[model samples]
Target: MPRVSPAHMEARRRQILEGAARCFARDGFHATSMQDILRETGLSAGAVYRYFPGKDAMIVDLAHHVLREVAAVFRDASLAERPPLPDVILGDSLTRAADLLTFPPSLIVQVWAETVRSPELATVLRTGLNNLVGHWRVLVEAYQRNGWMRPDVPAEHVARTLAACAQGYLLQSALVDRQDVSVVVEGLRGIMSIDAPTTQGT
Candidate 1:
């Protein structure tokens, strides 16, 4: 094949992004330097910059990419053929939540902390947070429509509270043991009158 022109550069950017995601997830947003991405992806400095203007851009891409990937996984299952109310919340949170927490829980914590330091990162974080919760919250609203939930409790409130609790647990788990997530997840479940949530497969 002839040498691809710079027009194809965006594809290469995504390639480096994969390496960034791996490094960020394995290490952290701050720890994974541009050099780490270069060595991991075997791309030159100029080439990396051509794709992402700076490290902040790379971090933004990583945050958006991972959140969208997880959201797709949860949204599909949660919106699929299922029961109502409680099942929606469990389906949305359990499988992917456990995986995210068990592995790259730091990703959320890092971005949440970064909001204080970086305005751009904070903007990206807010948008990503809204996207994930908004996507999952649809399922809950559907359940409410079918009379599966109490009318007094709004689906948006449930979604936001759950999002807040889960995000907090990810951050707090760093100071305490990861096992402590049980308390948070259980507490959230109690509010919905459902059994505790688990990342484990059914």
Candidate 2:
């Protein structure tokens, strides 16, 4: 018997994960069984199980994959030579967030539900959020130091506020059918705008 190459193994894993994502998105995670994934992937039960032992493990891997994609976006933006405008930063963030919607909104709902039942998954999400927000906080502080952003707001507050805004955008879009991304970008710009102080005397 010929052994599968590493690339082939990774491809098989991706196939299984993709199929599981569709299953979870269409049916609630609780309702999506291994059989559903098998049908979706056109793979045997053994093949699917070879990639993931159970639904919970598959969901965990999917959540980690999604979060890593988001984290990569933040990491790239944070490494820019100069801080980008708030609107620019948020626009890029929202674009990355949109990737989460590649499947039905129900997929996000399922992930959130699982987080409640699984402390480990919840911690994974929390850590990802912290990493994103911390990167933003550093960028915000740098912008403030360079007089590119409002000094009146605390960097940590700004970071959390922007993170909340991004999450709110995601939640609203998932809960609703439509979203005006421009509105969100503009709102973030407003929040991070630099203030010009008036001279008391000339």
Candidate 3:
């Protein structure tokens, strides 16, 4: 047999990762095994190891993949707006996440659970989520400079607050028996708005 090129190895790695994500998402990480991935991707044990040395590597990649996907969704929500306010940007984001769940729930939820058992997965989750919040802070500051957010509140504070709320909504939507996205949006709008009649101040 001929040796495989680096590009071929990378492609195979991606194929294995994609298949592993399906398995991990459906069965949870601990329950999944190399044999499961082999069945999912139709590759032999040696073939799988050629791309990923072990199962932890695949899960680390899966955690990264999930974070990248959430970041992309919020990034698209920002780009699609004509002149995006921080509120609209966030609202669009939660709405996008809500829609994504309707089709197939994200692997992020599974990844979060698996992190409890895997230190590498936990580290990936911590680092990736920090980076995501950082990107959001940058976007919030830009919107503040454009007068899209209130001038009094610090952009970083607003960014974290909104991210916390949105993350909570992700978990809540999974549990609750409702489709009240407006509930989240309205609550967030109240948190930021100064003209709310009752507590209108800096």
Highest lDDT model number: 2
In candidate 1, list every pair of residues with a backbone clash: none
Question: How high is each candidate's TM-score?
Answer: 0.67, 0.88, 0.71
- Across 1-202, the per-residue lDDT of candidate 3 in tens digits comes to 9998999888888888888877876777778888999999998998998778987898787557556766776666455544465567667666655554432344556667778888888988888768767767777877777776667878778778777887787667555544477887788778767665647579
- CA lDDT of every candidate: 0.68, 0.81, 0.72
Which candidate, 1 or 2, has the higher lDDT?
2
Q: Which candidate number would show the highest TM-score if scored against the true structure? A: 2
lDDT of 1 at 198: 48
RMSD in Å for all candidates = 7.3, 3.3, 4.4
Which ten residues in a row are the worst by lDDT in model 3? 98-107
What residue runs in model 3 are displaced by over 4 Å at the alpha carbon? 1-7, 72-83, 87-106, 176-194, 198-202
* lDDT for each residue of candidate 1 in 1-202, tens digit (9 for 90 to 100): 8977776876787788777767877888788888888998998998888778777787777667667766776567566676344434444554465664334555556666778988887887788778767865776676777777656777788777767765666677655566444576567667768554446676
Q: Quick one: how many clashes does candidate 1 have?
A: 0
RMSD of 3: 4.4
In candidate 1 the C-alpha lDDT for residue 28 amounts to 81
Can you write out model 2's per-residue Cα lDDT over 1-202, one digit (the tens) per residue? 9999999999999889988888888887888899998999999998988888999888888878877887777777778878676678778777776765468655777788788899988988888889889988988888888887669989999899878888787778778864777879987677656465665556
Tell me the deviation in Å of residue 171 in model 1.
Answer: 2.1
Q: Which ten residues in a row have the lowest lDDT in candidate 2?
A: 192-201
